[model samples]
Structure formats: C-alpha cells, structure tokens
Target: MIKHIGVVGAGQMGAGIALVAVQSGFETSIFEPSKQAQEKTKAYFQKKLPPHQPLFVTQLDALSNCDLLIEAIPEQEALKIKLFQELDSIAKPEAILASNTSSISITKLAAATKNPERVMGMHFMNPVPVMKLVELIRGLQTSDKTYHAVKATAEKMDKTTTTSKDIPGFIANRILMPMINEAFHALQEGLASAEDIDTTLKLGANHPMGPLTLADFIGLDTCVAILEIMDKKPCALLQQYVNAGWLGKKTGRGVFSYV
Candidate 1:
C-alpha cells in the first residue's frame, strides 16, 4: 500500500485530492509556493475535513519523499514541463508522477519527465466529491505499474476510474464542450435568455444545471482554452463575456450574477 501522497497546486483539485488521500490513511502533503493558496487550501480542509488529517507544505521539494506526487498545476505545457522536470529530479526512482491535466497530451508530458514509465494522467472532474468518475490516461511509454497504481489510488478514493488514451479534451469534456458551445449559440440567436437556456436543460433535458451555468462553473477562461485547443470557435456571447472580465462565480459574474 502507498503510504505517502504529494499533490502540487493548492487549487480546487489539489485540495480535494489531498483531503481524500488523508481521509483514506495516506500521509498527504500539498505543495504550493503561493502563501495565500496554501492558507486557502488549508482552510478548505479545516472546514470540510477531519482536524487530524495530514499537513500542507509550501515547497515543491517537500514532495521528494512521497511515494506518489500528483501534479494538479495549470494546463499549460511549459508550466507542467517545468514542474515535472523538478519533480523528476527530486522524487525517488520508483515514485509515480501523475498529472491532473484535462486536455494536455499525456505522452508529451511523460516524455518531458525523466521516467516516462512512471508518468500517467489522472483526470478528476470538477466538484471532486460529487463527481464520481476519473479518467486514467496512459502515455505511450507509461508502464503497467504506474497505470495500475494510479487506478488503485482512484479506487481507494471511492472514485470510478475509466481508462482513456490521451486526446484533446480527454473524454467527457470533449463531448460536453460542444454542447455548451451550442447553448451559447442558441442564446446568441435570441432563442432564450441564459436563465431560460438553463431551465430548459434542467427541466426539459433532466440535467442538474444548464449549459451556460455549467460553462460558468467550468470557468470562461478554461472554456476558451479548451475550445481553442479543440479547434472550436468560442460562441460569440461567451467571447464577449470573457472579454468583459465576467469569469463566473469565481469573479462574481457570468451567465448570471453571483449576487
């Protein structure tokens, strides 16, 4: 059994993963350089997790001793490469390196690391507790040991794991983004207000949230990033929303106002 888990980045995914790891008996540490991020992540854990859970650290070097270091940093290739390069030097030869990337190329990331055999992708959906599915991506050089280890970790987290080849948008988001883009198209066409669009989806389509609202939750910047990578044009209204700095609940405005 893996005894130690390290997570880089103290954002939503990293914090949630840390909470679940510690709750499952793994000694977990979250490494974030930014002080505010460190405190915010710890505060999140303090509120939602047990008081006796594992600690959080402020240096990436702290992850060297971990059995598994999961990188939940930004989706940019250069950033991931830089972090992986440092992690490769610090981590043990047998330690697994995992990426929480949504759409980046796993093979490229693996190749950037010293041990491609030990690198794999672990894509956890948003609202980690509520989302049950995780996508496990294997690079061309990923070894069986690394793949199975991450799969086992997800299982221990009580998450359903689906194996997928690295592709733009991975799996779910590949299909979901087009739908969200369509919703914006419909709204721009004057078929409905954002409220009406969402209502139609939740009531008529049996979804928990409407596409516009879901896009907001996903972050407009993230949506545009994914769309641009997928070679899909951003719906005009969304382009405008992104231009205006109304990024969503995180920014207090989007398809709907936070207040």
Candidate 2:
C-alpha cells in the first residue's frame, strides 16, 4: 500500500526512478539541491513523462509524508550515511527508506538510520525505465515486511525482482563489473582493438553490446569507482582513461571516443 514516493537526487538514475514511480500511479516528489539538475530533470519529464506535474522540492522537509523514499545519490558511503541519518529523522516512522546503491553495503547504510528495519536496498539497473530487473537487497536488520512491501512495489512498476543478502555489489555488479574490467585489460594488452573486443563478445557470447562499448555507456569513472568500493583492483588502463577525464559517453570519451 505504498504511496507518495519521494526520490532524492535528480541525476540519471534518480530521474529514471522518479519517472517509473509516477508512471506506476504513485504521487511522486523529487528532491534535487541543484537548480541546474532540476531543470534538466524537468525537461526530461516534460518530454517523456505524463503531463501531470510531479512535485520538485528543494528540501527534505517536503518529503516528510512519503511512504517510500529512495536515495539515488552518487555512490559515496559518507554522503549516503549522512543523507540516511537526515532521512531517518525526517521521514514518517513507518516509511521505508531505500538506497539505489550499486556496490555499497546495504547493512552499513541501514545502520545510519534509527529504524534499521525500514532500511533496505532497492538497486535498480542503469536506464531504469527500460531495465526489468530490480535487485531487492535485505540488510542485516531489514524487516521481512519492509522487504515484501518494496518487492510488491517493484512488481507494480512492471519490474522483476531478485533478492540478495547485503553484500558488496549485491548480485549484479559483483560479477558484471569484473567482466567489464577484464575487457579493459584485454584492450590494454593489445589482444585486440576496442571494436574487435566488443565484436567478439557480441558474436561469441551473444551479448547485446561488447564489454568495451558497455563500459563507455556505463561511464569509465563509475566502473572504476564500483571496483574500488568492492576492494577490487581496477584495470590500470581504465584508471588512465578516467585520469584523462575520458569518463565515457557522458564526457564523449572513454575506452572508445563518442566524439
């Protein structure tokens, strides 16, 4: 019976999640501190979402009535913890506070809140509007009721759910990021050109896109950040690309140039 969904952050993932929430018929509120980001999200929604306007708030106080608040901020542990602490104090007592973290520990994040039972991970894949799988991660103290409620909500949004214990990267990225990293290694070692590496995976593995190409789409800097959070050593070449500010399609350059 969750309604009045609130989403913090108005970046790519946050905007996508807010779009899904509204499409599912819930009254949605989006909180974004940056006016520039808010403008971008507004333009996106005007073009892609229903004509009905969603409340865009500049402060968390507006989200107090939300039954489910999903934090879609950048993947930083300290920032997430701070936000959760504030959310725990602001949101309704029974509200479920979820994080869309890709690699961070859900349990650790839950600890920041007073009511750990209401804290869990609702990790949506990139391009949230299109992706079907939503990883429902239960932290150490996440209640069964909270887990089921979020699962049902995901289903209502036409998304499939896979449950996982709170672990680094949960289920998806623990395996996916490493493969992307390996693709970078192959390119760095001169095994093949970026195009050839991707073509091999596309034809041999039947993947929709090649690893290098996918890396560019996902953003090279994001890939390195996830690997580092998981305590995995990132590919040196990937590091170099990030250092050069070639953060993939967002920056118009990465493993392959989009420019």
Candidate 3:
C-alpha cells in the first residue's frame, strides 16, 4: 500500500536506496544536510540509472507525506535518535520508519522514536543495486504489521528479505568486522602487504572481495567509528593509517589507493 518513500542521509546507502525505490515506481524523496552529499547523490542516480526511473526530487522537505522513511545515516546512536525524534513529528501518523543500520540495536533505535511499533530495521548490504538479500529486523515493540510491510517493500524493490533478531552487528558485519580486525593484526606483524593480505582471503577463503577492500567500500571512517563503539582496536597499522586521513575510497585512500 505504501506508494511513496523517503530516504534520509544521502550517503552511499541512502542514495542507493533512493535509486532502488524510484526505479521501482515509488515516489521517492531524499534528505541530506550537506549540499555536496545531496548533489553527489543526485548525480549518482542521474548518471547510474536509466532514463526510465522517475528520480523526481530536489530537496528534503519532500519527505513529510512519504509512506515509508528510510534512515541511512552514519552509525551514530545519538544522531539516529535525534533524527527519529524529528521524523516522528514530520511523517504521517501511519507512516513506517525504517533504519538501515547494520550493527546498531534495532530495539534501542525503535525506543528512541515516539511510536516504537512503527519503527524497525531494514538493513541492505553495500552496493544496494547488486545485493540480493535485505535483513528485516524487528524491535521489541515493532508491530507485526511493520514487519510484513517492510518485507513487501523489499520484495517490491526486488530484494530477498531475511529476518534477524535485535543484536549487535545483526548477522554479516558482526562476524565480518572481527575477521577484518584480525587481518589488520596480521598486517601489523609484517605478515604481508595490503594486496597480499587481500589476495589471501580471496583465494583461500574463496570470497569475492577481501576484507580490507570491503572495508574500503564500506568507508574506512565508518569502520573506525564502528570499531570504536565495539571497543575493538585494529592492528596498529590501521590506527596510524587513520591518523594520516587515509580512511578509504571516500577520501581517495585506504589499503588500496584511488584517484
């Protein structure tokens, strides 16, 4: 029944979600405070999408009447709570608010909103256009109606939906980040070059992308932020690299460099 969608944050995830929604024939709106991010998001869809997608949006205020609002901000609890508070006032009484948080607590996030029953987590993996599975997480108070609604929304977007319990890192990233942290440790011990480390995982683990490469795609700053919250310290290599502002592709540098 939800025909319109709103996406907050306009980061890689938000823009990608907005593209998916608009391409699926939903009227979509996206909110991004930074003028640069907003412009980049718009460009991403314009250049990356075919002409058929009705990517009709100019600014943030278009979100108020959207049937579902997707929050795809950085992984910060305080900021997310603040956003929910604002959206609670702006969105319609029956609109569903979904957070695309990979590691944050869905229950805690749900409680931050005025109506917890209307809030839930819909975690889409990176490169949204390509990822097939979408994790649907229900908070303690998230209504069953919201679950089905979100699942249906995912289906409409051509994504397979999987249910996850409210927990730290949910499914993929919990196991994934820890392994990546271990990889950092290996590098600091002079086990291998960054490329060698990545290659090892690709061939040995039969994985498509190495952890460091995946981390870069996820944004190294985001990795640092998540690790800080998890009380995890990567090998000293990452600490020093972070100090150099070599966060990742977002900054044109990481384990691998990008121009």
Candidate 4:
C-alpha cells in the first residue's frame, strides 16, 4: 500500500533508495535542502538509472502526502530527532516514518514523533541498488501493522528483509563495527602491513573486502560515530584519522589513501 514514497537527504544512501523506490514503480519524491546535493543526486540518477527519477522538492511539506517517508540523513542523533519532530507535524496522521540509521535506536527516534506506532527503522545497506538486505527494526511502540507494511514495501523493492529489536547498533553494526575496530587495533599494533591485513582477510577469511577498506567505504567518520553511540572504547588510530578529516572515500583518504 506504500504507493508514494518520500526520501529525505539527497546523499548517496537517500538518492539510492529513491532510485530503487521509483524503479519499483512507486511514486517517489526526495526532499533535500542542499542544491548541491540535489544536483549530485540528479547526476547520479542520470548515469545509473536514466529514464526514472524521483521528484526533487525543496520543502518538507512536499512530502506530506507520502505514504512512507524514509530519513537517510547523517548519523547524528540530535539532528535526526529534530527532523523527526518536524516530520511528525507535517506528515499525514497515518503515514509511516522510517529512519535509515545504521546504529541509532529506533525507539528513541519514534519518541520524537506523535504516532510512535508508525515510526520504525528501515536500514538499507549502502549502495542501495546493489545490496540485497534491508534491516527492518521495530521501535518499542511500533505496531505490527506498520512493520508488515514496511516489510512488504521492501519486498516490492526486491530487497531481502531481516528483523531487529530496538537496540543500539542493531544487528549489523553491533557485530560489524567491532570487527572494523579490531582492524584498526591490529594496524596500530603493527601486527601486519595494511595490504597484508586486507589480503589475509580477503584470501584467508573469505570476506568480500578487508575491514579497513570496508571502513573507508562506509566512511571512517561514520564508523567512529556508530562506535561512539554503541559506547565502545575509542580506538586512537581511528580517532586520529577522523581528526585529520580523512573520512574514507568521500574525503579521498581514510585508513588508506584513495588519492
């Protein structure tokens, strides 16, 4: 029943989700305040999914009619809460509001909305078009009806679904982030060269990409943010890299140089 989908934030994740939603035959709209980001998304769609694109809107009110609104903003809790509060007042009473947060608490986000039952988490993997998994999280007050509707919507978009409780880091990041952290720890200890470490994991452990490379792909800053939210001890090396503003591929440098 989610015929109209709206996406907030025109970053890689948001634009990717909007692409999938529209390709799946849903009426999709994307709301982004930044014209630069909007242009980037437009260019991305033209290259990756020509002939189909979501409506780009500058105002939040344009999403008021969306049957489902997915927030894919940065990984900041305060920013997300503030956006949800505003969305709660603008969206239709029955519309569902979902967050694409990787490690934040769905229940806490739901609390910002007036109708908690319609607030849930729909954590789509990065590069939404390629990733098959979509983690569906039920907030403390999220209703079964809302969960099912969102699950169906995910299926319509051809994504496999997994359910998670309202936990910090949820399932994916709870396990993944720690492993990435250990990768940094190993690097700091001089246990192996970054290349050898990545090679060992790729050939030995059979991981698609080495942990350090994956961290870069996910954004080192984002990795740190998720770890901080999970209350994990800081890894000095990771902090130093983040401090240098080498936020992985986006910034052209991270644990390794992308330039």
Candidate 5:
C-alpha cells in the first residue's frame, strides 16, 4: 500500500536510500536544498541507476503526496526534532514519518509530532544500497500498523529487517560503537601501532576491515556523535580526530592518512 516514498536530505545515506527505493519500484521524491548535494546525488544515480529518475526538489512541500517520508539528515537531535515538527504539519494524516538516525531516541522524536503513532525509526545502514540490514525501531507510541507497514516497505527494498526497542544506539550501534571505541582506546594507550592493531583484528578476528579502518569509513565525526549520545563516554582519541576536522575517508585524514 505504500507506493510513494519521500526522502529528505540527498547526502550519502539519503541518496543511497532513495536509490534503493527507486529500484524497488516506488515513486520517490527527495528534498535537498543544497545545489551541490543535489548534483552529487544526481551523479550517483546516473552512475548506479541510469534509467530511473526520482522527483528531486529544493522545497519540502514537494513531498506532500508521499506515503512515507524518511529523514536522512545529520545526526543532530535538535535538528531532527525541529524537522519532525514541521513534517508533522506537512505530511498527510496517515502517512508514516521515519528517521534514519543511528543512535537518537525514536520515542523522543515521536514526541515532537502531533500524532506519534505514525512516527518510527527506519534506521538504514550506511552505504544503504550495499548493506543488507535495516534496523526498525518502534517508539513508545509507535503502533503495530506503522511497524508492519515500514517492515514490508523495507522488504520491498530487498533488505533484511530487525526490530529493536527504542533504545539509545538501538541494536547495531549499541554493540558496534563500543568495540570501535575500545579500538581507539587501544591505539591511544600505545598498545599497538595503528597498522598492527588493524592487522591483528583483520587477521585474528576475521573482520572484513580493522576497527580503525571501519571507523574511518564510517566517518570519525559520526562515531563521535553516536558515542556522545549513547550511555558510554566517547574515547578521547576519537573526539580528538573529529576535533581536528579529520572525519576519516570523507576528509582525507582521520586516525590514518588517506592523502
């Protein structure tokens, strides 16, 4: 029954989610105010999906007709709550509003809207087109009807779905960030060289990439954000990287130099 999908923000996660939505045969509308971001997203679509085109607009009003609206903006709680308040007014009475937040509280986000039942967390993984899992979190007021509808929609995108309670960091980040933090701690304590630490994890733990490499890929700034919101304190080493504007792969330098 969910035919049209609206995506806010045309950044990496947003573009990836919109691409999958189009591939799943849903009518998609994406709102991105930045011309640079719009061009980047367009280029990405042209490269990955040459034929299909989702409606792209600079104004939020263009998404009024969408059956489901997914917000894929940055990981800032205040910004998200403000957007949700505005979306509550613009979205249809029955349309579902979902957030792609990694660690923020969905129940708290739902509190910003007039009808909380329809708001839930539809946290898609980074590089969404390639990742297989979609973590679905139900807010305290999220109804069964809303949950099932979003689950079916995610399945249509060919993603495996897992349900998590509305907790800080939810399931994926709750487990993943702590291990990543510990890796930063190890590096800071001079337990091993960055290369050695990464190599040990890759060879010994059989992980696809070492934790530092994964953190770089995930963006050091994002790691800091997720950790700051979680119950645990962020590793000082990680914050230092973010403080220096070394946000990993995107910034060309993080724990290691990519330049």
Candidate 6:
C-alpha cells in the first residue's frame, strides 16, 4: 500500500534510502533544507540512479502525498521529536512515519505525533543500497497494522526484515556496538595493532571487515553517540578519535586515516 515514499535529510543514508525506494518503483521524494546537501544528493543520483530522478524538495509540504515517510535525520532526540511533530502536521493523515534512528527511543519519538500507532523505527543499516538487513522496531503505541505494512514494504525493496522490541540500541547495535567498543579497548591496551586486530577478525572470526574498519564505515561519532544513548561509556581511544573530529570514512579519518 506504500506507493509513495518520502525521506527527510539528504545525507548519505537518506540519499541511499531514496535511491532504493525509487529503484524499487515507488514514487519517492527527498526533502533536504540545505542547498549543499541537496546538490550533493542530486550529483550522487545522477551517477548512480537511472534517467528518472526522485523529487528533491526544500519544503516539508512536498511530503503531503507520501504514504510512508522515513526520517533519516541525525541522532538527536529533540531534533527528531520536532521533525515528527512537524511531519504529523504536514503529511497526510494516513501516512506512516518511520525513523532510521540507531539508538533513540521509538516510543518517545512516536509520542511527539498525535497518531502514535503509525510511528515506528525502520533502522536500515548504513550504505542502505547494499545492506541487507532492516531492523523494524515497534514503539509502545505502534500498531500491528503499521508493523506488517512496513515489513512488507521492506521486503518489496529486497531487504530482510527483523522485528525488534523498542529498546535502547535495539538488537543490532546493542550487541554490535559493545563488541566494537571492546575492540577499541584491546587496541588501547596495546594487545594488538589495528591491522592485526581487524585481520584477526576478518580471517580468524570470518567477519567481512575488522571492527576498526567497521567502526570507520559506521562513523566513530555515530558509534560514540549510540554508546552514549545505551548508557555505556565509550572507550577512551574511541572518545579521543571522536574529539579529534576523525569521524570516519566520511571525514577521511577515524580509527585509521582514509587518506
């Protein structure tokens, strides 16, 4: 039933999700307030997407017709709540609202909107076009109807879906982030070099990428943010990297320099 999809925030995740939606034949629109981000997204789609382009809008009103609107904004709770409130007012009454938050509370986010039952978390992994898993989270008031509809839509986009109860970090990050943190601890302790640590995991544990590399790909700032949300203190080395603004591949630096 989700014939039209709208995404807020034209960042990497937003652009990737918008590309997937349009590639799967949904009429997609992306809303980004910043002209720089809009231009970046347009350039990305020009190279990756086919001739047709998803509507890129500078206003929230353009999302009025979207059957489902996925918010891929930053991980700030206040910002998300404000956007949800605005979306609830601007989008169609029947539109399903979803957040791509990795650590924030779905229940709290849903509370911002009058129609809490229609709000849920659709936490798509980074590099959305390639990531196979989409963690679907149900808020306290999220309806079964909303859950199933979003699950079906995710399947239509060729993604594997897993339902997770509304909890801090949910299933994926709850387990993954801790391990990545431990890896940082090991490195900080001088137990092994970053290369050896990652190589050990890649060859010894069969992980496709080492924890440090994965941390870079996920963005060290994001890892730190999620750790903070879970009430888990990030390792000192991780905090140091974040403080240095070496956020990861996006910034050309992180655990290891991309340049």
Which of the numbered candidates is closest to the native, going by highest lDDT? Answer: 6
Candidate 6: clashing pairs of residues: none
- Summing lDDT over every window of 10 consecutive residues in candidate 4, give the lowest-scoring window: 45-54
Q: Ten-residue segment with the worst summed lDDT in candidate 6?
A: 49-58
Local error of candidate 2 at residue 24 (angstroms): 0.9
- Per-residue lDDT of model 5, residues 168-249, tens digit only: 9999999999999999999999999999999999999999899999899888888988998996888998998888899998
What TM-score does candidate 1 reach? 0.94
Candidate 1 global lDDT: 0.85
> For candidate 3, lDDT tens digit of each residue in 1-259?
7998988988888888888888888888777888898778768877986445434455545688899999999999899888888888888999999999877788888887788899999999888989988999999999999999999999999999889888777777768888888888887888898899999999999989998898888887777766766667765777777888998887899888899
C-alpha displacement of 7 in model 5, angstroms?
0.8
Q: Which digits, one per residue and each the tens of the lDDT, describe model 2 over residues 5-70?
A: 999998888999999998888899999998988998999999995746689987898999999999
TM-score per candidate: 0.94, 0.96, 0.94, 0.97, 0.96, 0.97
Model 4 pairs in collision: none
What value does the lDDT take at residue 125 in candidate 1? Answer: 83
For each candidate, the alpha-carbon lDDT, in order, equals 0.85, 0.91, 0.84, 0.92, 0.92, 0.93
Clashes of each: 0, 0, 0, 0, 0, 0
Please write out the lDDT profile of model 6 over residues 111-228, one tens digit for every residue: 9999999999999998999999999999999999999999999999999999899999999999999999999999999999999999999999999999999999988988998999
Candidate 3's C-alpha lDDT? Answer: 0.84
lDDT of 4 by residue, 18-128 (tens): 999988999999998888889889988888864566899889998999999999999999999999999999999999999999988889989988799999999999889
> Candidate 2 vs. truth: CA RMSD?
1.2
Give the distance in Å from residue 46's predicted Cα in candidate 5 to where it truly belongs.
Answer: 1.3
* Residue lDDT tens for model 1, 20-74: 7887778888888778878888788779856456667766787888999989886
